[model samples]
Target: MSTSDDDYYSDGIDIRDLPKVSLHDHLDGGLRPQTIIELGEQIGLDLPATEAEDLADWFVDSCSAGNLPDYLKTFDLSIAVMQSEQGLRRVAREFVEDLVDDGVVYGEIRWAPEQHLQGGLSLDQTVVAVQAGIDEAIDDAVRDGRDIRIGQLVTAMRHADRGLEIAELAVRHRDRGVVGFDIAGAEAGFPPSRQRAAFDYLASEYFPVTVHAGEADGLDSIRGALFDGRALRLGHGVRIAEDITIERSDDENVYVSLGRLAQWVKDREIVLELSPSSNLQTGAIERWGDEMDDHPFDLLYQLGFRVTVNVDNRTMSATTLTRELGLLGDAFGYDLRDLESFQLNAAASAFLPLEEREELSERISAGFEAADNEGA
Candidate 1:
């Protein structure tokens, strides 16, 4: 998504200049259009739009329509270019580069390997190619004096039957750049309970998972994500807002109550990876209102829930973690401390090991401290 104008226009400190953690970014959803054209030509896949600008605008317009099916169809084009090893590597590398340029300190890139096997590559081969690109980009960013870290959240499609295999893939590659596992795609009909085998396998392997829940469905889907999938974090679990009730009250105070599910999520510190733009575009928060102010991110945070901002799809949502944070700041009057809290939440919710997560938190705190000290 766009990060150029994400400066702290109202917050007094430029949000883009702060270090951020991206927990819910998607690899397939963040492809560069020019790269798509180049890669598409090799595979003989005809693009809907030949020019990069048209393609970019097309993505923006398609996603802006606020329909989940239409939003997902854009991936058909991105996935078309990512079927081969070379295409996967190029896309992954650019994805990392784009994150570095956007000032992301850490990110977890999630995508299903099954979608890339149309080119005769095995699932393992796809992981290898994507990891190679991530490594190359990491080394390049280090050479450029930019410190950034990324981990793969190897994902399986919820409607697909590859959950167990993909969970095994993620665990197998855990030490080799894969950090976690996830299930995505059509959350309405496919609940996490359907992937019981995968979650069981992942739990047995001590693997981390973050399931896409509460986006296309409601509380039952979220319950399935937590109870069945054992998700360490909720992918756009913004719909947990539905579980909260606002009771009428007099001038003294407004009575608010949380359903059992919402209470459990809040008490357990389950991180809600809320993507404001994507939430609006996909109608995740349409029940609240049509604007960013309608988002329950503020409510969740106000209620002491572990809510972290995210850019669900960099291309489709056209957002960065910084932009998401900036928008939240604009909507809720949040400052640097609030932004830092979201980063801390993401750092904690990361699929990385505890030690690595602690280090990430330290880095984030230090970065924010330096920014504040310098500004002062």
Candidate 2:
């Protein structure tokens, strides 16, 4: 689709030029298909698709299967390449490069170290490799005159019993490169309550957290995310829309009531890291509809939720943060101010210290203000 004012979009600014902050991105989910193929070849792992372009197409097709397990199957190939220290470093480096290309000034890349241990790397070693890559990329970006900051969100598989371990790992690396902790996997059966030990430990240490909740499940899962996980943010918590009861509507406005869970998430300003393309592909918003237009993003924004846009998985969803914002602007007729609001939401929700978050917010506001003046 033309991102310019041609047929597809006329958001009054180059979406690519507008600075963005990505809070729910996944490290494994953002690998280039060609990189996967090359790394797999190095390790003698044959791929389902031989050609890089074909492999890219395969991933989009695979993730569109609309269930977490099916979506997760696409990761086998990417994770296969990411088994070694070299592989992890290369992918992490490229991840930041891609984010910079997408105009992201800040991003939190989440991935599971527990899964990468199949290749014999200890969790600490894998983190070291990933951090080396992040620092290398940061230096490269500085050389290129683009400043970006990225931190890791260490994740534990919900089906496993290593939440407490992963939580400790996250805290251990807090000053090194780690920013937060998360639980990712089957949500329906594996509730956050099951990881109470991890959550309690993280809470005691005052570690920030964001859980994948209310996407595959409903209100109870969301509650667990907040109370058990003590989530400072939510990963694709689109299904929280379920708690919003629309009682009546007129031509001008719609009347709705927010359930307590929904109310708390909204009032607390808990960031909703909503990925439009990924949510549709993963069926996270199937209760609403199968298409982007059917998404509750507009409703949530209208109802005062802290909805921040993200490209959860760049390769899997065949999207960039710019493309995601462009599609949303096209769909909702949002102007630069609206887009800035999303960025501000992400900046405010970052795992950074309060002073740094305020600085980021100021920088963002300055950029948008400059853009506004140019338009004027």
Candidate 3:
């Protein structure tokens, strides 16, 4: 099921044509390489590569460092070129356009606006500029007969102390395309408790939240995301696998046990934003193994945890939602039903209202059914 020439197919079906929902896509990490080269030049920033293909290759090679901190270093270049309003708008617009190219019907584009404010734009202005790009892209998509919807998930850096301010910023723009709040960056030392005030404020405002946990850190971080941050979903919560213990294995069955934390997450159906390629790149799944087959995604799915596949960084991982699904299919022998379940999980977990979420689920079902019929 490996992708060829940036396209993916599985079981006689074009994976790229299947309607998908992307919940954990990072806007800063999904920029076009040519755009980065152009914007970097405009800002007098020295890029490692001038050509788009070489720059794209550089990102993949640089981010494949097998550790989170090392992998994150590649973002400095992408974020640097995104300081101005024009840069942000272009990146955001193309971000949605690329989602449509990947057959994503709905996506939540998450990025830290504070990082993009250095080019003389205020926090609100940054959101507005990005939203402007998104709006333009959505309009273009509609005119081209492609239907897509996007939402902004405003993010605060975990190592920074602007949590409350970012939370307020997100709430202020809730009616202007922003749909949720999140905290990302180094997840080890800075737990969600560090942003308690922000979480408290967001909760008071009834804003949706998703915390980056269980990727660079472990269960305590996830507990903080759940209990302290009141996160509606977990970003790359793949490390929750640590809480499960394999008791033993027999000929036909493998006995296992789940800790209270894992049990609670499963019982409550907390969505795990599992990014197959990024998890491997960031060493989030190193505990299991270094390969996609080692990913706990199949295990989590088998255990009935609400799991959704994602492309955490399209540029860094050189992946799309289609490619991630194809890799999972290669690793776990997933069928069309398995893939549809992942989309359905993401649709339900989207920060959209319940009615909109239901409508999204209907779209996914219809799209997959059409693909199924074509294959049959």
Model 2 regions lying over 4 Å from their true place: 1-10
The candidate, 1 or 3, that scores higher on TM-score is 3
Instruction: Flag clash pairs in model 3.
Output: none
Q: Pairing residues by index, what is the TM-score of model 1?
A: 0.96
lDDT of 3 at 112: 98
Q: Is 2 or 3 the stronger prediction by TM-score?
A: 3
- Candidate 2 lDDT by residue in tens digits, 1-376: 3445323333455667777899999999999988988888888998888898999899999899888779988888888889889999999999999999888899999999998987899999999999999999999999999999999999999999899999999999999999999999888999999999999999999999999998788889999999888899988899889999999999999999999889989999888989999989988888888988889999999999999999989999989988888788767778888889999999999999999999999988988787677756
Stretches off by above 4 angstroms in model 3 are 3-5
lDDT for 278 in candidate 1 is: 94
> Candidate 3: deviation at residue 354, Å?
0.8
RMSD of each: 1.9, 1.7, 0.9
Model 1 Cα shift for residue 41 (angstroms): 2.3
Residue 251, candidate 2: alpha-carbon lDDT:
100
For model 2, what is the C-alpha lDDT against the true structure? 0.89
TM-score of 3: 0.99
